[model samples]
Target chain A: MNTVVRNEKYWLMAAGYIGAIFLWYASVKWLPISSFNRLPDPLSVIREWLSPDPSYGISIFTSDYYVHIWYSTYRAFTAFFLAVLLGVPLGIFMGWNAKFREFSGALVGLLRPIPPLAWVPLAILLFPGVEPAVIFVTFLVAFFATTMNTLVGVRSIDEDYFRAARCLGASRTDILRDVIVPGALPHIFTGLQIAMGAAWFSLVAGEMIAAQYGLGYVIWEAYNLIQYPTIVIGMATLGIVGFLSSAAIRWVGQRLMQWREESLGLGG
Target chain B: MEQVMKRDRGSNNSEGLAPRPEFGKLSIRNAGKTYDPQGSAVVAVHDCSIEIEAGDFVAIVGPSGCGKSTLMNVLAGFDNVTSGEVYLDDSLLASPRQAPSPGADRVVVFQNGALFPWKTVLENVTYGLLKTNAMSRASAEEKAKDFLSRCGGLDKVMRSYPAQLSSGMQRRVEIVRALVNEPRILLLDEPFRAMDTISKTTMHQHLLKMYSTCRRTIVFITHDLEEAIYLSDKVIVMTTRPGTVKLELTVPLPRPRTPEMTASVEYMDLKKEAIESVHEEAKKAFERGERELA
Candidate 1:
């Protein structure tokens, strides 16, 4: 009975999705073209997408597009990896040791609220060129949230776990590694997911400022030239990239926290 | 029945009848623990003192919020006492001891079992052996398997995680874990509270059997009088709130106590006494609270 209900729900979802796509195509066909006249028709776009002209669509993929994608991906990943390295330790330190929390906690609290985009001017002033700007913005976006979430995760661990570890003759370092790290993993992943999205958003805005290559730069350049298709493509690429990256992070999180799934009653 | 017979055969085959000191005597003198200094102090255990003899099965009974757990915490070296001290075998337990130095030889089984959720059943049992350099991994595995077998052997569930087991099964794992360690003092904090009556009775039997064989100084804490009466060699009844020892009643019942003994006249009388003492403690605790609020 439940399976039948679920089957019907899936069918309804498929129908709705198909209907929405058709409606979008029909609306685009009937709508009068204006400033956004370069808006490619759905069929034409699909045809162009399939049998693409190198000078038009495929050129975006070849020239500097790869480099731009690489640059953006690199910045996002570097910032994320660095955030994990720095944020997790700081979070653990703040969570485990009271004195460290008392000292560094207020500083984190003060800096956490300021948006990463707000750092663009500071990044420009501090360093030269696109790389520094992107890095700075990504770091700013990723660090605080990861650190705060990690702190919360560490703080919320069961006291019994700690006691059990201690009684088993676990060293302070062992407790941190074996008990605290695994205990805080779920929350840390949550922070990473949030930080990744923030970093992606910040990267786009950061790229708009002084980037020579990137999806953000492509969109900005296309907008200036009134080539709305390129702009739309850039927007679509960003959205797809963001969705895929978030999904990838969630996948990794699910694997890492598989043991916690039953306890949490998640993904039933 | 076959397993019990096998255990009997094994015991007969091994060292005859000399009792091994599973855990040594634990003495807590004037142990008092207070949380928060300036901020509305909550005194858990107030100048509480008790001596648990070697190989003695002891139960601490009290009303809810009676600081029974606090006393257990202090004894386990998990919490610091504001004043006073705890001594095991004449050595002071001021802080968590460094490895290789078996000061008190203690292991605690928590209310929730506190089994590492990440670890398998076998891994959890093998944890205590990991701390000591006394045994190799293979040897430890052998010893752990032996204990696991004795304590209703972990079947396919040996590889299973703690989250997979029933609450009773989890507690059994915890018991096996503690027993495998062969600690001098085994501290249990309402370990069987979550189990149903039948399971609880079965656990009590298993505990008595384990205790008789292991001969560890066991400190069982609970709010249940019947449980205390059934399992303990001596029962320590405690008052509530700023808790103190109310009375100590020794069970004259024979060792390897059975469930049938719970229905015995002496067992019933002891249960009555314990309940009455706890009721008085509960009344006084409430009156004290009312006075404080007033």
Candidate 2:
């Protein structure tokens, strides 16, 4: 009975969401005087999604919709993976030890205030290729935020914890691995979540400017062609990809630091 | 009862010695500490010296900022002294040069339990053993379980984090963590200050029982005269500011001290003397502050 009630509640929420979207569609259609044309009706967009190129003798599964999605998702994954590879270590180094903090902290601080898109010129000048540009922008977006938050987290750990570790005979390496890293993980995860969003935003911007094959490129291409349905489809795809990737980052964080959630009242 | 056992052991060991008497003594010879010469150069402790024998329970009592904590930190090799030296068992005491050895021989129980919030009670107790090669994981777990049982068996709350436990319970975990390694000298810094009266009494009894069984040298720092009197064999009275040892009073009270001893004439006299010493130091400290301001 409880599970049934929960399922009913879930359906209710879904209905409410769809109802809100329909309301938005009605307002946009009925309203007048705008440079951007009214968004295609929600049902028409859904129909386009379902039977995309039905007359082409191609399966719906192998349509442009899937291609667009695969391209967008692949780009996002690659950019995010590269961001993590660069960001996490830079963060850990800046956070875990004083010497690294002294050396790199000011430099990171100086670079962090500049928006990731501000580096577009530099990216173009240095590496004009589409992948390199996107990756560069993504790296710029993710690095500083992760480094700063990780530093805060490391600094916030109780001094007595270090003393206790030392008194118990922990080697410097052991302290870093067993204590410092775990202690700062929650903050590092938070930084990564923020970086994920930043990376996605920069990826889209980078793709819109220079990319040949990505969701942002498709959106711009559709806009020029005045294919409103395809444009909406591309926009929705970008939104969904960004949302899912962020949620996935949060999910990984929650799983790895499950104890922190229960104890620190975080990530619930 | 265990003091009697220790006395018997000491006597027997003393007789069997071939030539020289064994002196398990800790002597602090004219120790001094000054912080920040470019600043005010505050002397937390100066020219303070005391000697405690093995198996002795010595308490240092003084007013706030009298360097009681500083002295404790110095003894534990956590801080450097400006001058003078500390000798433990006739060897010069220095900061640890390598990973702490098994049975660290000097474990400190901080005022706050300072149990790692991320670790469970069992994990906290077994932390020191991680560096040791003597015990297998299973044996270490078994030993830790035994110590926890002595503390009060692990129930549902055993696996809970430090934040889940009460203040007194957290302190008990720290105490057990310190004792589990069987340290040679157990230094406690106001470990009972956070407890309620009932919990404090219970902890005092538990500590006494543990000391009696282990026969380890205990250096307890507190401001409470009654606590110092009740727990210590010798109470070292300290002056304020640039702290100096005023006097070392040996409590001749019989073993297994009871609460009634606090109301006894002898206990009252000793308590009065300790209070007077603190008051004098406090007054002098205030006057010195005034002169500095002027």
Candidate 3:
């Protein structure tokens, strides 16, 4: 019954978003505010997004919208998957093994601090093509986030869990599987969420610099053409795509860590 | 049913299939531990020696900071003694430089019952059996459920996680986990220290019941004199930091000890001896702390 009161806040959330869009509409179209007056109206942005305007840009009705969205999605997911494949195991090893930690820690520490954008020039020079270069930049961004987070996760598991496992007569393999993996899982999922966000952030930057087809490319093109409504459309599409991807990662994390969730008494 | 596990039989050693053998007779000879965290040495235990007969219940009582838990760690093979040796029957278990890894043969139940929070109560209980590969998965589950029921009031909580149960229930689950393995020696480091009065009494009763039925060798450490007197067959008192046994008292109180026996004169005399033995050492420790501060 108390959840009813707690849940009513969702209406206010909807109202707040709708109010902001309304304010954006009113300031530009009705109030004639100086800078915003010349800006694109919300209605025109929606109208342009739904129907064709070859002179202006492609809208939701055309295949161009999907092409850009799909392109961005593909690049982001591919980069993120590759980063996870390499980073999670590397991070776990770095945390668990002293010799491995000392050896790889130096390389990771030096490379992790360099901005993802700084890698762009080198990636472009090293890779065979621009697409590969962009993907590499995106992968680098996600990889650093994931590796550091996973390492922290592995390091943070309570020492008692390991001791408890040892007391149970668990072999080294058993301890790694039962104690270390499950103990580190909650942190790994947290890393995955952060990695997803970093992946999208880098994907846009990489695409803006060098990409044949993507939402970032579309946004840059619209800016060059002074297609203001189309620019807003590209941004809105990016926001939705990024949000959906992050939400998907969180969903998977929650499912995998349902044991934790259940123990914490957070109902599914 | 004797409420005890039988030794595994019909196994060939050449094929790497040795049936489990019964462990016995723990002996510690001049065991000591010292820590030097930042160059200065801090003695925790000094020349501690005790022999634990097979299946005997021994309780060690001392003031705080007396290295009781440290000694338990060395006994459980979680850490190596800085001096002397520990043995199980004829085999040397640990020495100054060598410590065996903690195994199913000796398990320690820590203060506050450190059962895995992520696991359900039954899962936690069955964990030891599964880890040692002592029983089939199906058999482990059945044994865990049976133990849970025999302990009483835990049948309904089998599916509940540690956080879902009270601390007392968690303690019970931890005990069940250790007992299911049929360990040779169970080292309980102040297991009842965190419980409330009602829960503590309940736990003591539960422990007494389990101890009588199973008759496994147990070493319990505590600060409570009355608790020590009530639960133990023999009580060993230790001096303050750099702890070594000061006195060993055998309780004449007979078995299936009840709440009523706690009021008996014998109980009071033993409690008095425990208090007297600890008082001098505790005062010395207090004065040393004061002098250091000054």
Candidate 4:
């Protein structure tokens, strides 16, 4: 009964989106709702995206769309990967050790609250290239999100687990491996999803200023050239990419933490 | 059939030849623990002491707020005594400078079992072996499987996580985990408190078998008077609040205590005595709390 309701719910959601698209297409194509008419019609955006570009002679099928996508993807992923690689261990270690927490916590505290976009000027000034600058700004956003969440993950573990490990003759390293890491994994995965979104968010913002080639750069460029349809294309691409990347992270998390999923019946 | 019997005999021989764990006698001398959480002070234990035989099954029963769990925490080395000392034979077990951390030699099977939720039954069982660096992974798995099978749960629960099993089954896995360490002393703090009567009885039987085979000193804490009388060789009753040993009654029932023994006169008498001691302490505890409130 619940599954049936859930299936109906998803169908309703899809219909809602379809209805929204219909409304937008109708409003722009027929109704001259002055303010809404100023925006590009979804149909024109779709056509321009699929058909050859007027200025560059490229479309969704061509390598041109992919090149912009690849630039954004590659930079965002590089930053996110570096964040996870550095952040998870650093977070876990800080969580486990008080001395380390006291030493590094001040710097983390000072930097983390600063908005991802706020660092754009600093990142641009520090790094020589546009690629490195954009990556740096996005990296800070994902890194802070991942690290803080991973730290909270470590702290949230039950005290029973630590005592049990000690009783079982676990050393510091053994407890970290067998208890802390696996215990905090569910939270780490959640952080990764959050971090992925933050990465894309700041990546787009970063590319608006820094990069030569990427979806964000294209959006800025299109806006400057007053290509309304192309602007919509860039935004739609960012939305799709962001949603897919977060979904991918969630999928990997579920796969690795199968025991949790099975217990909660989280899997389909 | 011959091959099976041959393997069994070989295992039996190996078990017999394995060095018996000879843990020193446990002694708690004038131990006291005072809690100073926030500004208020709560004295959980004060001048409480007891001597436990090397292989004896001892049960501590007391009123609520009597610090029974606190005492278990002290013995398990999870908490330090605020004053006095606990000793293993001639050596002091704890120090002011370094709080005594729990060792593999003293395994505690907590009330909740504390089985890692992420680990399978076999993995949880083999965890101690791996942590202690006692055996290679293959040997640990083989040995853990043997213990799990002996508990009659291997085939059904080997791959299951703690969440997938019943509370009773989780407790069995926990027991297997503790036994695998071959600990000298087993501390069970209300381990079967959450189980139904039938499950409790089953656990008591399993525990007895494990005790006889391992010959580890067992200190079990419980609120159930009948359980205390049924299981322990000596049952200690404690006073409430700033708890101290009130009474130590020796149960004279012979080895291999049966459920039928619950109906016996001796069992009833021992139960009556323990109940009487605990009731008085509980009344005192209530009065004490009332006085403080007033």
Candidate 5:
């Protein structure tokens, strides 16, 4: 019975995507709007994406397409990796210590509300080059997301766990390792998913504004050159890649948190 | 039954696994706790004093909001008293000036089941022993399995997380986790609250069996009078807000007590005494609530 429901859910999910694609195709082909005519139809975009030797240069078969994908993936991944490395520890300490939280919280409060796109000018000024600037701006958004989520994760842990740990003769280090880290992990992973999305968001914005070799650049370049299908291809690729990256984080989280997954019955 | 008998014999024969030294006499002298010291201070417990001898199972019973939990926190070293002192045998545990740190010697089986959900049942049980460096990893696992099996057969779910177990099983695991550490004093804050009747009964049997084998000091906190009478050597009733001991009743029931004892004349007499004392306090608390509403 459970498997039947799950299979039905999978079918529904597939139908949703297919329905959206059909709607896109219908709107572009049949709509009277001039904007719809200007926009490439879904069929043509898919054809251009799959073509071995495509018009207007970039396609799945072209080296330039992979180059754009690699650059965007590299930038987004580097920022995300750095964010997790720094943000997780900083978040742990922020939640753990009152004095440290007070000191760092002031800077975090000052910076957090500013949109990621707004950081482009300051990032360019702070870093020496476009590559560093784009990466820096992307890193900031993911860092705040990861750090804040991690801090909240640590705080969300029950006081009894701490009491139990201490009563069990756990040292400060042991408490941090055994209680704080594991307890906050669910939230940390939640933060990571958000951080990954934010990283992609800021990376694309940075790429469009400052950098020259990424999927964001491809979309902007295609727009300028009127390669309409390439723009759609860039967007579709970003959506798929962004989803895959977040899925990877979730996959790792599920592996590490088997106790939680099993309890949730996510395995079956 | 054969497994239980063999396990009992095994523990008796092992020198390393023998019961711990009896040094957990807890004495509280005029302990008081007032929350929010700076403004609008609310006294939770006032002039609460009790004496618990080593190897005695003492239960603190009171009406809801009677500061029973506040007193337990002081004994557990989670909070300190605003006045007076709490002593464990010779050493000071808590006071107005001296803050106490929770240690392996005083393990708490929290009412909400504090078994680390991330850890397997075996890991949770072995945690204290590992943390205190009381046993090597191999021996800790061995000892944990031994206690798990003894606690009504928890050995089968050794690899499972706390979330996978029933409330009764989780409660048993928590108790065994505390017992495995060989703490001088085992503090249970309404450890079996909210369990179904059948599970609660089974738990009582397991707890009594463990108590008989180990004979460690236990401080149980509950609002259930009958539970107080059945499980404890002495029941201390606390009055409502700014709570203090209203009455202390001793139970001279024989060891290895059975559920049948709850129906006996002596048990009923003791339960009657506890109920009257608690009812009087509950009436006062209800009146206070009504007055506040007014």
Candidate 6:
């Protein structure tokens, strides 16, 4: 009975997408607007996206499409990994130590307000290669996102937890290990999910300006060459891959924080 | 009587462990606590003195805002008193200028549950032993399992997270977690607050059973008059804000306390006296609250 209800919900959600595609097809074919005529229809875009021997250089069957995917995936993953490695500890230290919090809080306050893309010129100037420049820009946004969320995660813990831990004979290191870390895990995972999305967001912007490969560069290249359908294809690819990456992070979080799921009645 | 017999059956397995020595004698002398002393100082407790003998159960009751919890905090080493001193078995526990750091020797079961939500019941119970380096992991687990089973048959939920259990079960786990440490003094800050009457009554029985087996010194803070009279050896009533002991009633009732005793004539006399003393303070506190709001 539960599975039947879930299946119905899934089909209802799927219908939304189908309805969107149908609307796009109708807009281009039946609408009186000249702008709608200029836009590529959904069927033609799907055909071009699937074509083995396409008019444009990129398609699902071509090596170039996979190359673009690999490049974007590699950059986003690297940037996200670097952010988690540095940002988590930085956040923990800032929460645990007042002096460190004071020092880093000022630095973060100064830098976080500036947009990640705004660092493009400086990143390019600082690094000798375009790869480092784009990676550096993408890493900045992910780092701030992970660090700030992690810091908030640590702060959001109730003081009673600390009192209970102390009364249980936990030493300084014990409290940090058993109480602070586990207590803050839900927030840390929340930070990680946002960091993954931000990694993709800034990665694309950096690629549009600095990179020789990646979906962002492909979209820019397609636009310049007047391959309008390829633009839609590039966008769809970015959306699908970005969404999958975030879902992967969420899946990992659920496995690690099973207690949270159990509390919410979603786990055994 | 039935519940007491059932508890006796449950605790029969405790014969292997020797009875602990009665050693937690708490002494509080003219204790006073003030918050934000420099700016807008507010006195929470004043000239509050209490003497809790080893193996005795004492409950402190007062009106709301009467600083009962402040005294508990000072006793637990979570907060320092602004004046006077507190000692445990001749050792200075807290003074005007100094306060002992919270430790396993004085474990607290907070009003709201404080079990580590991430850890299982076994892990939570074994935490103090493992963290204090008092016992190895193997022995700690064995001891924890023993305590869990002895206290209301919590052994079945040993692997479950706190969120998976009922509120009553969570409170039971918290109590067992504190008891597993074998603290010199066990402090409870309204540990069973917000529980329904049925759960609270069951908890009272379980607590009595645990107390009989462990024989630890307990200082329970509560506003419930019946609870104070029902579970404790002595009940201390405090005046309103800047609280001080207004009355002390000793219970001459026998142990292995049954639920039926709550209706006895002797119990009613003690309850009436407690209500009369605490009622005046509650009225004062209500007026003070209104004045503050105004």
- Please state every model's RMSD to the true fold in angstroms: 5.2, 5.2, 6.3, 6.2, 4.8, 4.0
The C-alpha local distance difference test score for the whole of candidate 4 amounts to 0.85
Candidate 1: the clashing residue pairs are B23-B184
Model 4, first chain, TM-score of 0.93
Q: TM-score of candidate 6's chain B against its reference?
A: 0.92
Against the true two-chain complex, what DockQ does each candidate achieve?
A: 0.44, 0.33, 0.46, 0.59, 0.81, 0.80
Candidate 2: list runs displaced more than 4 Å: A1-23, A32-37, A52-63, A264-268, B1-24, B37-40, B95-103, B154-158, B258-261, B283-294
Candidate with better TM-score, 2 vs 3: 3
Order of quality (lDDT): 5, 6, 4, 3, 1, 2
> What 10-residue stretch in candidate 5 chain B is worst by lDDT?
B9-18
DockQ: which candidate is best? 5
Candidate 5 per-residue C-alpha lDDT over B206-293 given as tens digits, one digit per residue, 9 for 90 to 100? 8888887766899999998888889887899999998999998877665557899999998888888888889999999999999999
Please state the error at residue B123 of candidate 1 in Å.
2.2
Error of 4 at B50 (Å): 1.6
Q: What is the TM-score of each candidate against the true structure?
A: 0.88, 0.85, 0.91, 0.89, 0.94, 0.95
Candidate 3 lDDT, B188-279, residue by residue in tens:
88999977778888999898777765557789999888888888867999998899989988776666678899999878887887888889
Name the lDDT value of residue B219 in candidate 6. Answer: 93
Off by over 4 Å in 4: A1-10, A30-32, A52-58, B1-24, B35-42, B89-91, B95-99
Instruction: State how far residue A267 of model 3 sits from its true place (Å).
Output: 1.7
lDDT of 4 by residue, B1-294 (tens): 345434423432243223234674789888888999997888999999899867778899998899999888888888988888888756778645547779887889988778998888888988989888659999999888888887665546888778877787788889889988878788998999998999999989888767656667789999888898888878999989889999998787655678999999878888888888899998998898899899
Better of 1 and 5 by lDDT: 5
TM-score evaluated only on chain B, model 2: 0.84
How well does candidate 2 score on lDDT at residue A91?
70
What DockQ number belongs to candidate 6?
Answer: 0.80
Rank by DockQ (best first): 5, 6, 4, 3, 1, 2
C-alpha RMSD in Å of predicted model 3 compared with the true structure: 6.3
Model 6 residue runs over 4 Å out of place are: B1-20
Comparison by lDDT, 3 against 4, better one: 4
